[model samples]
Target: MSFQDEFNSGVLEVISPSPAYYPDTSRLRITLGDPPERVRWRSKQNLDFAYLMMYSQPKAVFYDQLDDILAKPHFITTMKIAAYDRIANKQSRFVLDFCQLGFIGKMFRCVELPWLVQLFFMFYSDKPVDRLLENEIHTKVSLLATDDAACRRAKDELWVHYKPSLFQHIGTQPSLKEKLKKSGNAEHPSDRFYNTTVEVLLKIVPLSEASENMTSDGYVIIGKFDSRCIAEGVVSQKLGAFSELRLTVHSVSDNRAILSEIFIWGQEAR
Candidate 1:
């Protein structure tokens, strides 16, 4: 079944905890107002904010362990959740980050505590906008402490990530004011995505005379004869090392072929 279908049928569960609320149905209490300029630097701290998308088996989390962490006064609860989940399940979780549109060439993968770090930055960081710089520092430090705790439990390798991101933010508008100011370049098209096909160009060049007449099986066929030394073709099948390319050079005066270069083009190749 599709992931969404499974999620709706209770075959899957996504535990996305918010920073604004506690397990006891009470809002987290924190100072409210603008943050001081000195404390603003702390906001730039690098935190793993890529754990929003994770898949796990049912009952992976031990409620007892989760409760133990939640009972503490930590601001980054998502990290704690991930830590205990690993402890109980004894297995790694796959996390994916949203791929920005128009950035297909720059796709990458890394292990990260996805939703855990962003929770503080997205929800709680702005709540105490007017708090003293010291309070802000304390809050930021508390977030880091929880992150450290989670990392200690969930090793760096425990988090596996998929490449050519499968997820992307739905809309073009940015949710945060800082991002909104740069919204013009914030949204673009993504070239790669999970389980999706992409178009690529394949070119082949003769490294030497030995490779010119190499057999390419039936994966490619000569499409055009540019010159006595140059040839172009279309890939009839997926090209690979096993697809032995054979170039039969033919001369105008003598029935001899001398291939200088070969160009191959197709919808996809490997």
Candidate 2:
């Protein structure tokens, strides 16, 4: 099976290549071994559209709006009650079916948004889950994203679209002002379009040291010489010595020197 990779902080995580992978929920979880000795954080944008779509991704929280209001009983017990009986009739699917169960299990595996979408349950739920007291809780939920919800922020009011589970998870509507007070570091897929990658710095140092370091990191340096004639002589002397290595030039006072090093291979995990 194919795999996908994500760079988070100093570590790299690889997961299932499923297209459904998102920051909140994923199908598989695996780390790409241990942290590399050194890593350069490259600003790459592969999922900018998805990241841009989110207004304020709320932290996964435990919020039960119907804590004392609705009794926590069996999955269908609340459905049979007077408050949910009407909802049951409208929704014939009593218990979760196999497909629903699979997706629900996936959600459970992620452990973020549960079965309830208290306010905007429609976004996350195919059919209302009265069993979770979310059907009626819709009336109490103030957070909303209309059918024609726009991605743009609303003036004088913060706006969110598509993710109603945020309201149910946060227990209350989020304050955009509060969210903006903090900074965001996650890279979006569209970020590459506007990303300005400039030459941060330039260093003129000894080539042997730099080449040695690269070699230690699994880079195959074929030759390190001061001039083309000397590089040819060194290679001619050891015909097949650096055949498997990638040829490189490191000149110093007309002298040739070659250093070998080890390095880890591959980026991220699959």
Candidate 3:
């Protein structure tokens, strides 16, 4: 069978039947539980933003917060589409936001993201990057647990990283400008990024000469994984800011695909 045939047949796992709300609503009075307390910030990044946001809130209230989001359609489907944006348009933030809301690899799982979506999210973020990258283009921080320059740069980038596409405001976003303009970063936060770094989960598959072997569907044997396994990855550079440059890794057999996702952060990063 063709790679496409195999891909459509199994490897990919769906998020189950679907994520939909009942179209019909009936009034039913019920006793309520204890009131929810305010959630305090655990860290500067609040990596557990989803969990903390939902943990303290009552179940009804927790889901209610996502009413605007859930009311539209099954988030799984929406995120799946968003995953494509990340791949097709290099919209890394969209994919990351999906993971943020869906909690891709978190322990205190809140929502479920389809397996393929998770892969695409990571693949795009894990663009191959040069360790010696400077400061101009999108740069990646090493996931090391030491106070070092590279790690510091990485953490700072993660802290300052922002994407305007995620917002729908009407005017200039002064708040974002302010966030981007801040200084005073630690000389070194740590050293050595993690294997689980969200944008660093790349699997490199080298091909001999794919043009000759590849099928019309653009499918190629990729280390037993599909080409659409994840989003395109960070690029190799001397030193740069975050980028939206999409790297096409499925052209020739010799060409390799670089994929990444937010599989690691917070405690896992340590």
Candidate 4:
């Protein structure tokens, strides 16, 4: 069978079921989390701003926080016609907002994601990225553990070593007029690009508070396009931010035949 045929047959897992509220649609409520030590700062050359980079260890992986999952990777996609509901039903909204408080992952239990939507994640990122997920990108998902303290330590060291310049102490620098003008125009192209991507994602997704829970907290965002494609576009649009960008579809159950979950991750440099 063709890849498409395989996808339609039993290859892809569905995370939601059809219903009138979503009418001819399916959804999976996605939840995300980070470890307390996974958050850190990075610098972009042009903007004179520090971009926050969230990290993870091999055993200490980030999760979508969905409940009763079979613990395996699932294949999925976001066709052009896919759309997400703006008004999550009252019941669904409650599920999305409350998934984190339950210590679902910390205590090794699953919590209900909105159940009206699907979830996805990033399983791996090669140091030197060659390409990114776009239309029809394929991937699998899996579970990770936090038992390897050594892996976590290695990740911490690597993060500190290659983190982008934070323009540390910029607040102490004088904001001279001419200097400001030169500095504004002198901003790095890469930094500008990076800022743009974050801004776009913020506008499109339900981003967490800028100053809130740097680690141990995350956001669930709904956009009109296939998440995998959007993620790939962002990665390609800001290719220099990292050496690689990839994703996995953990659970998908949309009836619209157009949508899928797209999870993102920040990786260590090779």
Best by TM-score: 1
TM-score of 3: 0.18
Question: 121, model 3: CA deviation in Å?
Answer: 24
RMSD, every candidate, angstroms: 18.9, 23.1, 22.5, 25.0
Worst 10 residues of 4 by lDDT: 41-50
Q: Candidate 4 — what's its lDDT?
A: 0.21
* lDDT for each residue of candidate 2 in 52-156, tens digit (9 for 90 to 100): 212112432211112111122352332224224434556322122111110121111112233332222233222213222323223223345343233111211
Q: For each of the candidates, give the backbone clash count.
A: 25, 10, 39, 15
For residues 147-166, could you state the per-residue lDDT of candidate 1 as single tens digits? 76664344323323223333
Candidate 1 wrongly placed segments (more than 4 Å): 1-123, 126-156, 180-270
The alpha-carbon deviation from the true structure for residue 2 of candidate 3, after best TM-score superposition, in angstroms, is 44
C-alpha TM-score for every candidate: 0.21, 0.16, 0.18, 0.14
Evaluated against the true structure, the overall lDDT of model 1 is 0.31
Could you arrange the candidates by lDDT from highest to lowest? 1, 3, 2, 4
The predicted structure with the larger lDDT, 1 or 3, is 1
Cα displacement (angstroms), candidate 1, residue 261, comes to 34
lDDT (CA) per prediction: 0.31, 0.24, 0.27, 0.21
Number of the predicted model whose lDDT against the real structure is largest: 1
| Residue 187 in model 2: lDDT | 20
Q: Cα deviation in Å at residue 154, candidate 1?
A: 11
